[model samples]
Target: MAWALGANSNSPPFAPAIGANAISTMRAAFLIGIFAAAGALTQGGAISETVGADLIGGVTITPLAASTGLLVAASFMIFGVYSGYPVPAAFATTGALVGVGLSLGGDPAFGTYQRIGTFWLLVPPMSGGLAYVTATLLRREEVPETVGVPLLAAVVGAILANIRLGVIPHPERAQGSLAEAASFAVGRPLVAGVDVVAILATVVVAAVGFRYIRAKTQVSAEQGIRTFLLILGSVVAFSSGGSQVGLATGPLENLYSVELGLPSIILLGIGALGILAGAWMGAPRLLQATSREYAQLGARRSIAALVPGFIIAQVAIALGIPISFNNIIISGVIGGGLAAGSAGVSRRKIGVTLAFWVITLVMSIAIGFGLYRLLSTVLGIQ
Candidate 1:
């Protein structure tokens, strides 16, 4: 499960970087593997809990059911990896879990389904719109490079300041943002106004950093954009780990206690390893596909696309929502492409990918439900 999810999910964050030639495929994979593992170990718990326990009601997922759901989901994703179609792992995993849960006589958690579905529907448009607007602004001749790039960097920095990190909070409480963690470290109580201060400080620091980079003799405007895009790629990769690890580990949460009796951390570690392996071995093909097929993005357009991808991915993680990085990246790529005109975008490719996403959702559910019944009956375990 982790191998499949990792291969599919880990590629998009760095695809734009690759497209812009800001980073090499191997370097992106290496950075993605390390940061993604960190994210999984630190912040994977909430979404895992949501996937394992909150998606259904009235029954616990037995080891057999969990394994069946994961198998169905992973098989579909593996098929996508080999076939060169980017299937949405979130849709597959969520559908599979719900299917298996229903087969086990669990009640539908319609409210949870509604929340997840709403986000799934909203992310593409939201991400695309933001990227389109950003790209448009960046292309304007009147927008000075010094002011425009730094202002955008400031916004990204502000968002980063507020993102909840898993390693910076009390064990029993939810995570804290960088500012809150800093405040705690300094032995100051977290007041209501502290976030505003943190935001301002982050923006100022980012603005200064961008200004410095721009002033460097070796760093051209294009190079500055590349550097920023690489940073955004890393941020998005870390967020991907936080969001995608749950899809692999969620089903196994119950099984960890019931059968294996392993700690959650250990399960997370296993998932991280699978993700690392997949990122190293299987991610390059999809990375090439996304970077080349979706859009031909330059450094400015790449940054425009990646900023929203980073923000949206982090938002999904904070909300414990399972989202498709493919959806996010493709939307952003299309948005950036649209900034150049419709000619830059490939409608046929988009249609095919969307079709695959819809088909995978339905097929995964059916497979998960049918496979569980067949496996349980054959093994006489249910």
Candidate 2:
């Protein structure tokens, strides 16, 4: 599961940077591995809880069921990665889980499904629309480079400031944002105004950073933009790790109840290793597919696409939602492609990709259900 997810999820975050030549494929893989592992260790709990514990009711995911579901989902993802079409790992995992759950006589958690479904429906349009607007504004001659770039940077910084990190005070219980951590340190109560303050502070810091980068004679504006793109990609990679790790580890959470049960941290560590391996070994092909096949994006458009991808990813993580990084990045790419004109985009490819997304979900569910029943009845296990 980890290997499959690592391959699928780790590539998109760094694909833009690789595509823009801001970073090499190997370096991107290394950074992705590091940041993703950090994210998994620190912030992978919430979504893991949701996937393992909240998706189905009246049944605990048995070891056999968990392994079977993960194996099926991973196999599908592996096939996609090698075939140069990135499958939605979340859909595959969710479908497989639901399939296995139903086989075990578990009822659907409709409320949870509603929430997940809503996010799945919203991500493409929302991220794509936001990217379109941002890309359009950045391309406008009226919007000066000095004004536009810093504004976008400020928005990113504000999001960063408010994003919850797992290494805060109550690491075992709840997460904490940078603002909340600062507030606690200074002996200030976490009032409603703290968010506003954090945003303002982050904006100032971003503006200063942008100004410094722009002022450097050694660094051209294009170089500065590339640097920013790399940063955005890295941040998004980290967020991907946090969000994607849960999908792999959630089913394994059931193992904790057995006699030789591993701890949550250990499971997370194992998942992190899988993600790292996937990033190193399997991410390059899909990265190329997304970065080149989907759209031709320059540094500016790449940055625009990644900004929304990062934001949407963080939002999903915060809500304990499992999302496809491929969907997010591709939507952003399409949005960026539209800014240049539809001539740069491939309509047929997009159509096929969308169809596969729907097919994978339904197929995984059916396969999982059938496979579980076959295994149980044939082996007389469970």
Candidate 3:
């Protein structure tokens, strides 16, 4: 999402705060590493789990194959991020995984493919339309601040409350609602009378307590809207992490599951580390590529991009589909650009990026399939 990029973006004011020397560069690297690690733990882990479990149903990945796939995909992602190009990691990795898996005796899950393709195709137009509408509404003079802000807050609260949660790769084992989790922790059944009582108690406390405090502050409606947007952006970032890392680590599913002698958690940890490293060492360039190349963005524009990106990424994660962060962000950028008007963005740059996306997917699939076939023949694999 745009805010994810914006948050990591070195603002103009911060540019002069650090020098561009070896020591400074080293320090930057250090910070990048830390940020990347955090990114990996969240995004990488989610991505890996999706790739491993959903790519081919009813068959566990082999160690050699998984490692081969992961190494290849991750290398390309790092290359793109470092070279200041937005490599659609999800496109490349997912295509590669399908190529490799199909060549290795896996059947194509046509339904899954269709679902993923639908989301991928839908995002650009949907995001653009939503951004246009949101921008228009915000520009309106008659929309009341009190009503508008609370409505936004309710929307954000609904999204946060419904996000899937449980152990990775096991949707059925979900922790259920936040209220359910709390009730379960206290030895009460989620559907029992006790649970209902506890839920009411918590709701009363949160609503009354928050309302009392908010009334005391008497904050302006604009302030409330800003707060809601901020909260929404944060949730979106967390979801983005869950989705983007899959491209980084999905290829390694076999190694983590077999050779590494690990479960989903352990594999997720390893993938997370790789993502963290990538984010720290390689994330900034891609961030720059997006921020500078897409459109000139203020805070509101940035938030618009991020919200949709986050939503799409989380959806991909849930479906066990691989996706490109670059594409997702671009969809948002295009949406924001449309809202701003036709002349506000670079048509040439958009064309180039689109070309690259097409080429990347085609090339990655061809190479992956070819490599899998060659390897299988050389190894006498069945």
Candidate 4:
């Protein structure tokens, strides 16, 4: 599953950078693997919890259930790889889990479903709208390239200050953010549930980020732009690892952590390795695909696409939501492409991809339910 995911995800974040000739293909793939591993280790826990524990109720997930669910989900994703449509990994896994849970007589987790479903629905429009607006801003003649580009860097820096991570000083040793550490040092000042110190810290970081990007731009506009694209691609690639690893490791979360009395970090580490291997072994071909397909869009639109991808990815991680990077990236691509007018975008391709997403979700549910029931009966394990 991780291998399939790596192949499926290879195109979105780094491809545009490759398309823009910002970095070599092999180097981008190498960095993607390493950063993805880092993200999985640091930020994969919340999503693992959501997938393994919160999606189903009234029954514990047995080893058999885990195997069954993962089998169904992984099979669907591998099929997607050969078929050439990027399957929604989160949706496939979530549906398969739901199916196996039902087969085990677990009740539906309606609240989790509601929250996840709502977010899933909003992804297309929200990502699209943000990318559209961002692309438009970058193209505006009134806004200088230095100011506009640096402003984006500053926003990302502000967000980075608040991105939750599996780190020190978090309650239960689970998670905390850079902003939280800043607030901790300042006697825990808070106003309207916002950390005053954190805000100041984010402001300082944003200023630094803006200044650095601006300086880079002033030296050589084109090179600075390409360099920033490389950096942005790396950031989004890291976010993809954080967001995507859960789909592969989610089913094993309970089996490895609770049944074996092991730590969740160990489970996340296992998933991280799978992702690393997958990225290294399988990412080049798809990266080449995008090198051809995405080059025509140019750098600014690609930047617009990736900025929303980074923002939405972090938001999903903070909320403990299982997300498909494909959905967010494609939506952003479409939105960003539209900024250049209709010629750059494809309507039929969008329609086909959208249909496939729905089909993947529904089919995974049915297959998972049937497969689990058959496997359980045959093995007498449940």
Tell how far residue 306 is off in model 2, in angstroms: 0.6
Cα lDDT tens digits, model 3, 122-176, are 8777666665566555546696545444444444444444455543222245325
Per residue, candidate 2 scores C-alpha lDDT tens digits across 1-382 of 8888888877888887777778887788788888887788777888898889888899999988888889889988999899988899899999999999999889999999999999999999998898898889889999877667766766777787778876776434578877666655655544664555555556666666566545531346676677778878888888898999999999888786353566688888888899989888888788888887888787778887899999998889888998888899889988977998988778988998999999999999999999999998998985
List model 4 lDDT by residue over 294-374, tens digit each.
325678887888899999999999899998887888888888889889687767777888999999899988998999999
> Candidate 1: RMSD over Cα atoms?
2.1
82: Cα error in model 2, Å: 0.4
lDDT of 1 by residue, 216-331 (tens): 31357776777778878887888888889999999889889567788788888898898888888888888888888888988788878888988888878878888888899889
Error of 2 at 171 (Å): 8.7
The whole-model lDDT of each prediction reads 0.83, 0.83, 0.55, 0.83
Score every model by TM-score.
0.94, 0.94, 0.74, 0.94
| Number of the top TM-score candidate | 4
Look at candidate 1 and tell me the lDDT of residue 279: 86
lDDT of 1 at 336: 86
Better of 2 and 3 by lDDT: 2
- Residue 95: error of model 1 in Å? 0.6
